[model samples]
Structure formats: C-alpha cells, structure tokens
Target: MLVDSHCHLDFPDFAEELDAVVDRARQAGVGRMVTICTYLSRFDRILAVAERYDDVLCSLGVHPHQAAEEIGGVTVERLVELSRHPKVIGLGETGLDYFYDKSPRDIQQECFRRHIRASVETGLPLIIHTRDADDDTMRIVREEAAGQPVKGLLHCFSSGRQLAEDALDFGFSLSLSGIVTFKKSEELRDIVRDVPLDRILVETDAPYLAPVPFRGKRNEPAYVAHTAACVAEVKGVDAAELARRTTENFFRLFDRADPSRQAAA
Candidate 1:
C-alpha cells in the first residue's frame, strides 16, 4: 500500500483524465491521496473531487505562492471553520517559497503564520512548502510554532540538514517527492537515507513532479511507486517495507480517514 500525500489532482493537467488518473493510482496500489488546495476559490472544487473519490482526501488553505491574493480578509479562524468537514484532513501545502517568489516575501510569511495558527487551533497538521528560503522558513516555523505544539510535514523537502533538524525538533514530519529520484538529488537522497521512518512520508505533488522514467512529463498519483523505490534504495530497505511505512505514516498523520469512516465512503 502507498499514499501520494501531496498532489494537485484539481489542476488542469489532470482535468481531462481525472478518472483515469485515479484508476491508475488504484492499479499502482496507491491507497490514498490528498489533493492540495492552493486557494480558497478552488477549495470547493477540490473538495468535490475528494467527495467523488473514495480513495482521495483534501486539504484546505492557500499556498504561500498565492499570498498576495490571500492577504486581505483571510484569517486563521476561517481555515479552522472550513476544516470541520471530515474530508478536509489537513491545513496546507502552505509555507514559504522564495524560489519563485510568485508572491511578496512578507506576504508569504504572513500567510504562513495564519495557516500555522489554524493548524494549531484545529489540530490538523500543516503541509509546508518551502524552497530556497530555508532560513526564513525555519525562523517563521520556530517563532510562530513556539509553544503551539503544531504538527506538520514539510512537503517536497529539498532543504539543508539544519532546517530538517529544526523541523524535526519541532515535531514535524518530512515528506519526500519526485525530486529524490533525480540523479542529481544526492543531497535529498541522503536526507531520505537518514530521516527516521516513523517521521517520514511520501508524496508526488502530482500533475507536477513525476519521478524518473516519466521525468519532465505530467506527474500522477500512479508514479509514486518510483519515489517509493528510490527511498527504498536510499534507506537500504525493501520497497515493500517503504510502501508499508509510508502508507502507515499517511494514515497516522491524516487520522480523520479512519477505516470505519472511509469504509462508509
């Protein structure tokens, strides 16, 4: 079993073949996937997709890249309010991303703080997305998360050792993505090698970061196996064990999808 914990199935790349994509994921033994929400305007649509599929779950909150659009009138209370839905299992894909700087840096930090507050209040782990901004990312996470006992996973992790250590210290999980499979991702591969199994997760960030053999193509939930294979290689564990561990970690983190409730779905 496996879970693609971070994917954007709602993106247009999967629009025409959503059912096929879901079927492929099922065929690949992907037990579950979380369609990340990048903005509130599209959260409803993504939630509907989750509602439509028995194997898929959804998260609410904007990506840091969209901070400029999110600044006005947004509040942590609002995200908490939305999370009452059982299908909404987490609070993000939110955090800082200076690589693109699509949105203003300060605004991204503010948006990140809001989501952290909501995660703290609602008891849902945040799914952070940091890139080329490790210092700011760790600083904000540490400061805002102070005394909050926040839970989260840094999705698509490609940061340095110090940031990884700090995040782990704060009781956070680290998720690996397609990037780990790249021949040039020796650093990330090393991280995968060392990250404790119980504190690690796997994702595709699908319709985006497909693993090798399909690199540069549109990613889907099905390609998560490649990532699992890569992690297995890095950690010197069997692929089956890696799959089992990540699937277990997935359910543990997104505990809202308990068997009885999901079975009813």
Candidate 2:
C-alpha cells in the first residue's frame, strides 16, 4: 500500500473529475492520501473531501502565499480549535516562500509561528512548505519547535543537504515529491538517498511537480508510485519496499489515523 502524504485535490484543476482521479490512485496502489488546504478559507472544501473519501485525510492551515489574504481562520487559537475535528489530522501546509513572495514575508513568518504553536498545542504533525527561504525556514523550525516540542515534515522538499540534515537533526521528517523524478533532480536524488528510510515520506504534490513520463501532466496520488520508483532506484531498493517503508513512515508520522479507518478502507 502507498500513501501520498501531500496533494491538493481541492484545487480547481481536479474539480471536474476528482473521483476519477482518486479511482486511478487506488488502482495504482495508493491506499491513502492527505489533501492540503492552502488557504484557511478553503478549509471547508478540503474537509468535505476528507469526509467524503474514507481513505483521505486533510490538514487545516494557511499557505505562505496566501498569508496576506485575510487568514482569520489560522490564528494560533483558531488553528488549535479546528484541529479538534476528527477528520483534520494535522496543522499545516505552512512555512516560507521567498521565491514567490506573493505574500508579505513577515506575515508568512507570523503564520508559520501560529502553526507551530498549534502543533505544540495539539499532538499533530505539521506539513511545511518552503522555497528559496531555507535559512529562515530552518531557523524558524528550531525557534518555534524549541518553545514547545512538535513533529513536522518538509513537504515537496527541494533544498540542499545542509537543510535536510538540519531538519532531521531537529526531529523533522522529509517528504519527497515528483520533483525528484525530473531530469535536473540529481542533487535531490543524492539527498533522498541520505535521508533515513524511517524519516522519509513520499508525496505527489499533485497539480504540480508531475514525475517523468507524466511530466507536464496533471499529477495525482496515483503518480506517487513513479516518485517512489525514482527514490527506490536512487537508494538501491525495490519499489515495493520503498512503498511499504514509506507507507509505514507516513502512518508513523501521521499517527492520528485510526486502525479502524485503515481496516474499513
């Protein structure tokens, strides 16, 4: 079984035929997925999907790019309060993105801190997003996690070895997406091999970062098998083993999944 730790099924890119997309994922051995909420206002859209799909889980938080768009739902207290929902298993898709800077950098940092605080308040993992802001991201990771302990995973990671090492050292996990399957991902491949299997998770980050052969195509949880294959090839392991290990690590990190949910699905 495989689990796509991050995807954006709520995005309009999949709105027309989302069920067909998910069906393809199950056929591809993707047993589970976690659809992300980029803006707190879209929480209901993501939540409805999680409630609709027995095998899908969702997170509640604001994305860095959407930080400036009236994030009234992601205040520290509000995040903690919403996390109380049974279907909402995690605290974010939050972090920095200096590359785009679509949202104010300072606001992004404040939103990131709120998520970390919420994670500390609620025993849940954080799904972080970072780009061209590695230094600030790692610094915030340490500073925020230091105040109160929390577990998190860097989603769609595309950083250097130092960032990976620092994240691991800080007790964070690293999730690889289809980007590792791209032609220019050699450096990322090396980093993938370096990350401990138990500390790794696989994602599709769909509607973005589509893997090779499917490059430039609309990605979904199903395509994670390709990313898994790419990671296994880099690490000199079988794809099934990679799938099994990553699936195990996925549940280990997102421990809120009930055994009955697994059995029911």
Predicted candidate 1 versus true structure: per-residue lDDT over 1-265, tens digit per residue = 8999999988988889899999999999999989999997678898999999988999998888788897674688789898999889998878888889999999999999998888878889889999898888878877887886788899998888888988888788999999999999998777777789888898999888789989999899999999999988888899999998888888787778667656776
Model 1 local distance difference test score: 0.88
Which digits, one per residue and each the tens of the lDDT, describe model 2 over residues 1-265? 9899999999999999999999999999999889998888879899999998998999998889999884555688888878888778788899999999999999899989889888988979999999999899988877877856788999999899999998999889999999999999899998988899888889999989899889998888899999999998998999999998998888778878756555776
Lowest lDDT block of 10, candidate 2: 256-265
Off by over 4 Å in 2: 258-265
Candidate 1's TM-score: 0.96
| Clash numbers, per candidate | 0, 0
lDDT, each prediction = 0.88, 0.89
Q: Residue 59 error for model 1, in Å?
A: 0.3
